[model samples]
Structure formats: C-alpha cells, structure tokens
Target chain A: MDIVVENLVKRYGNVEAVKGISFSVKHGETFGFLGPNGAGKTTTIYILTTILKPTSGRAIVAGYDVVREPHNVRRHIGVVFQDPSLDDNLTGYENLYIHGKLYGLNNTLLKERIAEVLKFVELYEFKDKCVKSYSGGMRRRLEIARAMLHVPRILFLDEPTLGLDPQTRIHIWDYIKRLKDEHGVTIFLTTHYMEEAEILCNRVAIIDRGKIIALGSPDELKSIIGNDIIYVRVDNNIDVCSKLSIDGIQSCKTIDGETIAIQVRKASEAIPEILRYLEKAEIKVKEVSYRRPSLNDVFIHLTGREIRDSGGGFIDIVRMRHRVR
Target chain B: MMESMYIMIYRQLKRFIRAKSRVVGMILNNILWLVFFGLGWAYTLRGPIASALFRGLDYLAFLLPGIFTTSIFQASFMGGISVIWDKQFGFLKEVLVAPTPRSLTILGRAIGDALVSVVNGLIMLSLGFMLTSHLNPLALPIILVIGLMVALGFTSMGIAIASTMRSPEGFQLIVGLLTLPTTLLSGAMFPLSNAPYWMQLAALVLPLTYAVDLIRFHLVGISFLSSVYWWLTPEIELLLLVIISVILIFIAIEMFKRTTIE
Candidate 1:
C-alpha cells in the first residue's frame, strides 16, 4: 500500500471531525474520498500529509509514518491544497521555482523541471504573468505544476476542482489523468463531485459525518444499492409499494409527495410489474423513467438523505473566493 | 537544510521588492521621517539654550540617529505584517508544509526584514546628510551594524506576535501597543535623560533604547545609557541588542510552534 490508516480519529474539542476511519491506497492507484463539505475529507488529508496530527490513530504515507516520520513522508508526497496557497505577487514560474527550491531541488534541476512541468500543464506561455493576473483556472494549473515539481511518489489533491467551470474542470482533469498514466504516480484525491469520483477514481470511500459509510469501485458501490432505479410521478395514495412483492423490485422509496423512487434488480424487468400493480388500483401515472443507479442513489440509499442536503454544511471561503475571482 | 533557508530568504526578498507600492511606500515613509518629522523636532529642540539639553551637538545631528533608529524600529515592527498577510491569504501554508524547520522560516524572514530595514536606514542616512550635513563617512559601518541589530530584534518580536495573532486588526493593535510606547520611551523624540524616572525604567527594558543609544554614540559620539550607567558603552549596547535579537528570535520560534493555521 502507498498509504495506510488504522482507526484514524481527529477531534476538535467536543466535535469529532474524523471518527475511526481505516483505509488504504494501492501503489500507483488513484484513490478518492468522496464526501460533502464538513465530512472530514480535508482533515483526513491533513493528517496524511503530516500537517495535522490524528487524535487517536496513525497513517503511513509512502512507507513512512505520518506522525513519527513526517519529514520522510514529506519528501515523498506532494500536495495541492484546497486553499489559495500560491503567492499572488509572484509569477507562475517563480512560484514553481520557489516550491522546488523548498523541496531541496537544486537550481539546475529546478530550471529543467520548471520548464518541463510548465509545458506539461500547458502554462508555459503564461509563466511570466503574476498569479494575481492569471485567471482562476490558470492559478489552479500552476499549483498542480508546482506540486509535481519534486516528482513525489504520491500526489494528494484536496478538492482539486471544487469551484471550477465545467470546461476548466475538464481541462484540469485531463492533466490529472496524465499524471497517473504518464508518470505512474499514485494519486489520493478528496472531492464532493460524484461524477468526478466515478470518472477519475479507481476506488472511492464514501464518507459522511466523520465516518466512511461505504468503500469500493464505482460499479461495486452502485451495485450495493441496486442495479437500476425506477422513478415515477403518480397521483396516488401513500404506501404505494406495500403489497408489491415482485421478484425484481429490491426496494421502494417515496422521493417526494408525488413521486416514488424504486430500486430494482433490472429496470426493464421490474417497471412492467410495478406498472401493472399500480394500474390494477386505477392509479393515474404522470411520468415514468428508469435508469442505472447513480452514486447519488447509492448515497441516498445508505444515508436516507440525498448527498447535497445532508447539511453540506459550511461554505468554503477559498473556493468561494476563487469563484468570485 | 540550508537550501530551504536560502529559498525562504529569496522568497521574502523577492516578495518585498516585487511589491512596487511597498518599495516606493517604504522609501517615501523614510523620506517623510527624515525631511519632515526629524526637521520639525530639530527646530523645536535646537539653539544655544537647547544646546546643553541636547548634549552639545545640534538637534538635527542628534535627531539623525534617532530617526534612523526609528526607521529600524518601525520597519522591523511592521515587517511581520507580511506574515499575517501570508497566513490570511494562505501563502504561508506553502512555507509551513515544506520540509523546513520552523526556526529557519522565522530566521529567513528575520534576515530579509533586517536587510530591508538596513536599506531603509541607509536611505534615511543619506537624507539625513542632505538635511543636517553631519553624517561622518567613517560611521557608516557602525550605523549599519546597529541598524541590523535593531531590525533583527524588533523583527523577531513582530513575527512572534504575528504568529500568535489571528486577525490583521489584532496584529495591528498589538503591534501598535508594543512598538509605540517602546519607540516613544526609547527617547526617539526627547532625550532619555529628560524623561521621568518611571519612564526611564520603562525605556530601559526596551530594545529600542539600546538601539538608539548605540546609533547615537556612533553617529554623534554621544551616549545616553553609557553616560548614566558605567557598563552601557557602545560595545555593551551592541551586546544587549545581540542578546535581545537572539531571545526574540527564540521566542518567535517558540510561539510559532503553537500556531496551527496551516
């Protein structure tokens, strides 16, 4: 394993920010922790990066203990934090140069790596511009380039695309993909975007309220809830599925006053049985749709609440500032 | 080990210089003190009757080292504003997460601030020469050395306080509370001898008192503490400044250890 944690806990006063969470990332794998805001994703990353200590547990990064061997862990891991950690006064190249220098990279190697990484991020032409002058997307790209300077074994990204536009987020994701495919570096990422985790992560741990609720590949996780979803908007009485014991109907939920969300083994096989059962009661159906179960469905199935409304919690000012910029 | 130290120093130097407004503002602030503040004080405190009060040297000559030392005090004290800015703006996270000792971070910042303070002192020194025509060319090195000690001593205090402070307003309030009384009590405006016993006792504990007395001795061949206290010659004042700098730097490192912003 490139990263390991055993019962990691972090408590701030009376609030336990992170409960006893245990997980590991394989070498050269892209692992993600997916959660909404205030879900301890960032705190877990802080501990693994050696910036914050765990209250009752420990993590090993790159074979070095995060607490006892922090310096050694630091040497082998790179981090692109969620905040605006770059100096706005410095140009893009200058920022990378300073970061490389801090990592103990000498001037000559720093020069070469700066050239390479800037071009790799496709920010070479804008390298001379001050970060303050760069757009939000450019600044994020530069941070990514800076993190890659020392060529660490594992790169940790805390909400790497928190508040980016669709196009810019895709652009950033392309570079992230290249980091794993081309460089073969292990990537540990934390994000709230379900699609982002599904697309980029090899395996994801769905965390909520300081605990990991479920962990697996995207398909495996979605499979835990059911294979398909049958959503219908019907004007009918409540307890719509009390007597329906169809073979394919796994579970049923009243999504709202006028809609019912059904978890099924196969939507094609299950929706006909559901329609027949409702039709016999002379129910008037407004709309009917069925599709593969999404990660959002999995979250709702496990938590009994939608992912976004589980008190997504505080507004991260750094991401807000990036948006305003 | 030293590589990160040098990198941190370079980062600070580049940051200090690249902010054109700050560079211009620092030089302008230096000029304002020398041309206006120093001259205004000298006019009120000069002439035959005031000669004995100022210890025989003209008030402008006496005010030269005072203003120069004042620049060191203000520049170094305000230098920690960058630390606060870094913390608020999140740039300090980059520095803190790097595999560098916290002491070296404080040290590099202190050295960069001290160098900048010396530059401000030198500019004020030149402006002093223009206004007073009393700068001894031979005293440049001594003025620079004393300026460094003053800068380092105050810069350490400023950074230490900044490490503990959370908000910019809190930093400003605390810095003002600290640097104001110390600058005033160090006898920047009036001679220390003219101050009351209570104020003198207050001034004795301030690093600025030692800085001003050392710079005064070098620039004008006058010593306030050395004349009153036998052990406080120019050499002793320099030693005090050095010790003060070391203690303050240690305090800054200790305080920074408890700072958990990143």
Candidate 2:
C-alpha cells in the first residue's frame, strides 16, 4: 500500500471531524475520498498530509507514520489544495523556481525539472507572465505543475476542481489521469463531484458526516444497488408498479406517484418485457428512460438525501478555516 | 537550509523593490517629519534654550537620529505583515509543507526585513545629512553600524508581532498604536530627565529608546537616556538590545511554528 489509515480520528473541541475512519490506497492507484463539501474530506487529507494532527488514530504514507515521521512524508508527497496557493506577484517561472528551492532541489536539477514540468503542463510559453494575469484554469495548471516539480511519490489534491468551470475541470482531470499513467504516482484526491470520482478514481470511499459509509470500486459500488435503473413515467403508474413487482425486477418504487423506478440486472432484457405488459394493460406510458446506476443514486440510496448546493459542509470548512489560524 | 534562507531573502528584496508605493511612502514619511518637526524644533531649541537639555548640540542634528530610528523601526517591524499576506494568499501553507526546517522561513523574513530596513535607514540618514548640513564624516561608519544594528533589532521585533497578527490592517493598527507612544517616550522629541519615575521606567522598556539613544550618542556624542541608571551604560544598552532582538526572533519562530493550515 502507498497510503494507509488505521482508524484515523480528528476532533476540534467536542466535535469529531473524522470518526475513526480506516482505509488504504494501493501504489499508483487513483484513490478518491468522495464526499460533498465538508464531509471530513479536507480534514482527513490534512491529517494524512501532516497539516493537522489526528486525535486518536494514525495514517502512514509511503512507509512512514504521519505523526512520527512527518518530514519524511512531506519530502516524498505533493499536495494541491482546494484554493489557489500561487503568489500572483511572481512570474510562473519564479514561483516554480522558489518551490523547487524549498524542496531542496539542486540548482541544475531544479532548472531542468522546472522546464520539463512547465512544458508538460503547456505553461512554458507563459512562464514569464505574472500569475495575476493567468486565468483560473491556467493558475490551477501552474499550481499542479508546481506540485509535481519535486516528482513526489504521492499527490494529494483537495477538491482540485472546486469552483472551476466544467471545461477547466476537464482540463485538470486530463492531466491527473496522465500523471498516473505516465509516472505511476499514487493520486489521493477529494471531491464532491460524483462524476469526477466515477471517471478518475479506480476505487472510492463514500464519506459522509465524518464516517466512511461505503467503499469500493465504481463498478462494485453500482453493482450493490443493481445493474441498471429503469425509469418509466406512465399515466397509469399504479399499473406499472404492480407489474414490475414480478420476475426479473429487483425492486420497484413509485416516485411522487408519477414515475415507477424499476431496478433490474439486465435493463435491455427487462425493458421490452415491461413494455409488453404495459401495452397489454393499455397503461399508456408518458415517457421512459433507462441507464446504469450512478454514484449519485448510490449516495441517495445510502443517505436518503440528495447532495445539493446548500450542503452544510461548505460553511463549516470556510468558517473554521479563518478561526483556526 | 542555507539555500532556502538565501532564496527567501532574495524573494523579499525582489518584492520590496517592486512595491513602488512602499519606497515612496517611506521617503515621504521621512521628508515630512524632517521638514515639519525637525526644522520646527530647530527654531525653538537654538542657542541658550536649555543648553543642558541637548548638551549644546544643534537641534536638527539632534532630531535626525530620532527620525532615523523611528522610520527604520516602523518599516522593519511593519514589514512582518508579509507573513499575514502569505497566510491569506495560501502561500504559507505551501512553504510549511516543504522539506526544509520551519525556522528558516521565520529567519528569512526577519533577515529580509533587517536588510531592507537598513537601506531605508541609510536613505533617511542621507536625507538627514542633507537637511541638517551637520554631516559628521568621521562618525559615519559607527553611525551606519549602529543604524544597521537598530534596524536588525527592530525588524525582529516587527516579525514577532506580525506572526501572531492574522490581518495586515490589524497588524498596522497595533503597530501604529505602539509607534506613537514609544516615539513620545523615547526622548525623541524632548529630554526624559524631568519626567516622572514611572514614565522613565516605561521608556526604558521600549527597544526604540535604546536605538534612539545609541544613534544619538554616536552622531552627536550625547545621551541622557543612558543616564537613567548609574550602571545603564552605552555598552549595557547595546547588549540589552542585542539580547532582546535574539529573543524576539526566537519568539517569532515559535509563533510561526504554532501557525496552522488555516
């Protein structure tokens, strides 16, 4: 394992931010801490990265215990925080040069690596430009480039795509995927975006309210609910719900008394049969849609609530950030 | 460690040079004080106006040392607000997670402020020489040495105070409150002799008092603040300032250590 957490717990006063969570990441794998805003995701990353101390449990990164060997962990790992950490006054090149120096990179290797990383991120042409002039996407790319200058074994990204446009978010994810394929660096990132987790993470741990409610590969997690979900919006919904209760249907739910959500192992095989039954009953279906189960559905099934904009997690992260320092 | 310190100091100097407003503001502050107060005091303290008060020294010459100390003290100490800036910008977290020892970051700020304040002090000194026309060519070396010492000492004091301050406005407000009272009590504007014993004790505790007294004694060969105690000699004040500066920098490192990911 490249990273391991053995019952990690972190508390601020009487509130527990992380409640004895345990998980592990294999080497070179993209392991995601999938949670909305303040589900203890940032706190866990902080503890694992040695930014904050855990109250009772411990985490080990790259064969070193975080509490006992923080320096070693820092030397070998890199981090890109949720917020922008770049110094706008400095040129992109200067910022990277200074970060290189801080990591004790030798003068020659620092120069070589700075050039290489900047070019890889396609930022070499604009390296001389002040960071203030760069767009949000460019700045995020530069921060990621800076994080990789030392070529760390593991990279920790705390909501790396937070507040960014969808286009920019895709650009960052492209680089993240490339890093794992080309360099084999272990990636441990946290995000509230379920699609991001589904696409990038090889395995994800669904965290909520400081606990790991579910953990598995994307396929494994979706398989737990069923293979597929079929939504049938019919005028005679009671007829469809009663008919879906027969064979080949894992479960059927009537939503708002308008649509019947039917889960089955084979959506393609069941849809035609369900259509036949509806036609025989003269049900007159209004609309129909079917797709595989998503991480969002899994979260809703587990928590019995949807992750929305007013997710109480955001305010806690912002309010506590200012008061702590 | 040494590499990080050198680069950090270089970064600070680069930042200082780029901040054109800061340079102009420091020069203007010095010019305003010298013309309005130094020249204004010149007319009142001339010939036989308590010769014992200034020890027969010219008032403008007397006023120059105090101005030098005040400017350097303000600039160097307030420069510590850069830490709060780094904190706000999220750069401090990046630096903290680096492999280098934590102390280097604090030391870098202290030394950078010290060097910048030294230059700032000399600029005020040159302007002081031009305005007063009382240049002591023979005393120039000792004056610069003492000036550098005062700059380093006070810059450390600034970093110590700044490390605990989370905002630049709050840092400036606290530094402003401190600068006024210390300047008044340091005998920068008048002699501390006839002041109450309690006021004298308060003056003794301020680091600026020692800096002003040391610079004045070096430039004009007179310092009544040193006569506060029989054993409070020039050497003792210098020793105390040095000790206080080291202690302050040490305190700054400790405060920097306590700073978190927030």
lDDT of 2 by residue, B1-262 (tens): 7888877887888778877898898788777888888888888777676566677777888788887777778777778788888889988888888888888966876788778887887887888878766657577787777766676667767777767778899988988898789889987777788899999999988988888887787777776776767676778878887888778777878877888865
Interface RMSD for every prediction, one decimal? 1.1, 1.1
Candidate 2, CAPRI quality class derived from DockQ:
medium
| Docking class for candidate 1 | medium
Cα lDDT computed for each candidate against the true fold? 0.84, 0.82
Model 2 lDDT, residue B195, Cα: 91
Residue-wise lDDT of candidate 1 within A11-111, one digit each (tens)? 99999999999999999999999887889999998899888889999799999998898889988988999987999999999999889878889889999
Q: DockQ for each candidate?
A: 0.75, 0.70
- lDDT tens digits, residue span B1-262, model 1: 7877777778878887888898898889878777687777777776787888887877788878887898788888888888889888888878877877877777888888888878878887887788776657799987887788778878888888898887889989888887778778887667888678888888998878888888888887788777777888888788878888889888988887667764
Candidate 1, residue A88: the lDDT equals 94
Chain A (alone) TM-scores for all candidate structures:
0.88, 0.82
CA error at residue B31 for candidate 1, angstroms:
2.2
Interface RMSD (Å) of candidate 2? 1.1
TM-score of each: 0.92, 0.88
Highest lDDT model number? 1
